[model samples]
Target: MVEPGPTTPTSPATPTDPATPTNPTNPTPAPVASPVATNGKLQVVGNQIQNQNGVAVQLKGMSLFWSQWGGAFYNASVVNSLADNWKVTVVRAAMGVEEGGYLTNPAAEKARVKTVVDAAIAKGIYVIIDWHDHNATQHTAQAKAFFTEMAQLYKNTPNVIFEIFNEPDYESWNEVRAYAVEIIGAIRGVGAPNLVVVGTPTWSQGVDAAASNPITQYPNVAYTLHFYAGTHGQWLRDRADAALSKGIALFVTEFGTCDASGNGNLKLDETGRWIDFMNSRKLSWANWSLHDKPETASALVPGASTTGNWPDSALTPSGAFIKQKLLQ
Candidate 1:
């Protein structure tokens, strides 16, 4: 997660003009809204996101992979379980990536995103529409189109957040920043005021890189870094601390309990320490998944009994963690 802080202005940079048409072939005029001040800060009802004094708001939550491409096994019960049982205040939804074979068709993909977004809104929880796999080659146009539509649809909804790109592994920070800036401009053009989340390099595990560049010029923009304990635990913690020291806001949008050395599958002991650190800092976080069926492909799913059946005792250790730490 990136830490929250003050935004500094960039050097006389002009925000991309919203009225300028990008696609003449699609002659539909872009959505419009009243002009608001652009001071590079997150605003709600014309006010910036302020810290609640020194008290840290516990933002424990989970992510949902509800689209068919991502193995659309999540049902309505899953959503209700998280909100009602886990008391999750946030939900990360993969916005149907283009490569996820299930969403190769654009129309179906849009419908899938709407399904998850609508469910999250009904629960009165903050939902993040993640542009998964935005780092894949030649996805700029797809990302722009997807974000533009989403911004136009949910611009006025404060509970909605936009993650412009999932994890940009191959691109340099400069390249990623340019792409993010372009997408942010497009969303702003659509009159959306939702907080936009930008990813750092190295699969969004580079919080130091994010801090060095800083998204101070974009209002309501938060630098996002994912942490997989199996790969980058210490670095994640150090980068998070550094971002906080710089007064920048961060969200631990993704993490798992695997060992940092990748020796085995899951390691709860190491993850517990990370969780404690996040809680101490008062940082916001979301677990990777909430799927309930072990027969399904998701790691978060509960296990099954004999005869290939999902038994009542199928909950994963991580799921139990959510029940204990986040739920109650």
Candidate 2:
């Protein structure tokens, strides 16, 4: 997530109360089933994301903001709301690793991330555990350990996707590739068959670079390509086409309707084109965020309930647009 100004830290919202019967006389209904029950495990098959049965599948969902900042929505109620109301099939847990994040408070950060992850599992939707760091290469050891632990814990579950790197700032494709190899090895080393996503160079825009030299060792490995419609246009799509032509899979792990700065005008026209492109190519994606920050990318108003019973009034224009897309 890119920020144009300093962020005002918000207190973490408490988790929503567990399901309760509306009336004392009636019993609560069983939770609605989620997409995972049907899709099962996911795999990357030559530029496409396929379900365990080898059929192409596209997952539409929202991404939680950096764990340290957007920790309010990291709970079952939020996930349940998205699954039950917005009809999202997946959600990304962006665990911030630096700047007073996991590096400073590992337990708290991990707990927040796990809250979303476990919620997604209980709701039966896929969840991406993203290492939301810009300088991931420098903390290879920490990342490896973190992912290794996650893999061991969730290896048998098919609802997890490990995003080794969120976005690489100035690193070259080769440098990112080397770091990814180690992380990918750690996940696969633990016998986890879940798909792993690696970020590209220049903040995940260099899909063509990754295509030229893709990871050949991993079977379910996919590359990430992030864009803000206002700042990135057809040129990035063209670059993505080049990567797809090379038989490398791509996943738009994070994107916004505004500019790259995460604040600015909403470019619905360009976002439409991206939707068409992604739909045509059957690309799986998670919107940039589900936070209540004061930005164009934020889905809700500042005072909106963090426990996830948001009405139309609570949603921003961007949130409404994304919610409509997911529903479609």
Candidate 3:
């Protein structure tokens, strides 16, 4: 996970307009039209995430940094700007639940998530309401309650996706699955049929474990596999490849081109390989972050405004890289 500290802005940003969100040389790339209809919702079908029409769909977009710390990017204007300027198909609302976040202020954190979700829905894009926690199993009741509320609120909307956990550092697949089993049941019990992504052990790098013993209790469940290009190489890809061959539904809910620390030179070569792997699988993915934190993965520079519209100078190399990818 990208550490939230290192730089914390002390003041709340008064929201700004959604204008040019990048440098002029970048020319605020034109937003492309999507073929996917506004009414269609993503569905899980036999190792693939397909559109409502049953065609395999690949979503490319960005994930906000932890909500508790990076709340500045959790606004509708920012979501709209990305959809318009970058032409992304989905966005992940990474709601942090620990370290003075949801546990300390549940209502506020939930509001942060809802802001992005509401924006996605209004803009006709898929949104992942991620429970951004490392030890989600430890807070089973909290996870259940948060998901249940979200499921009920967006029950009929196909645009909403649920991620019960973010990263599990050292849990067994059996243990992670046990936590997922209950949380998945809770979301389904609320009559929400949208796709739910469950995190695998070891920071979601244990897809092979989930593949060996799949979650059979639910229908629209997919295993999450997160990777950072500098840290995870072919060994990780081989694991994911093996799992895919076994017919496990996998989703790249979060990933970065930099190292695990979220700061490192962009390993262009390695990141390219990971992109190729995901493209081959036609996987849906959201980049690690949209924050202006001083990290290689942040995509923006420190002191960048909270508004979604950023200038070229504000964009980091990773931000420029992601904007180009979203265009594809």
Among these predicted structures, which one has the highest TM-score?
2
Taking the tens digit of each residue's C-alpha lDDT, what string does model 2 give over 111-154?
88777877777778999999999999999999999999888877
Which residue runs of candidate 1 sit more than 4 Å off their true CA positions? 1-58, 69-71, 101-103, 134-137, 259-263, 292-312
Which ten residues in a row are the worst by lDDT in model 2? 20-29
Model 1 residue 305 distance off true place after TM-score fit, in angstroms: 13
Cα deviation of 290, candidate 1, in Å: 2.0
Tens digits of per-residue lDDT for model 1, 226-288: 775655667668877887676666777776665422124665766778889888776667776
The best candidate in terms of lDDT: 2
> Which lDDT value does model 2 have at 105?
82
Greater-TM-score candidate between 1 and 3: 3
TM-score, model 2 to reference: 0.93
RMSD of 2: 5.0
Model 2 whole-model lDDT (C-alpha atoms) = 0.86
Measure candidate 1: CA RMSD.
11.7
> For each predicted model, how many residue pairs clash, with residues at least 3 apart or on different chains?
17, 0, 6
**Better structure of 1 and 3 per lDDT:** 3
TM-score of 1: 0.75
RMSD of 3: 6.2
Candidate 2 stretches with Cα past 4 Å from truth are: 13-33
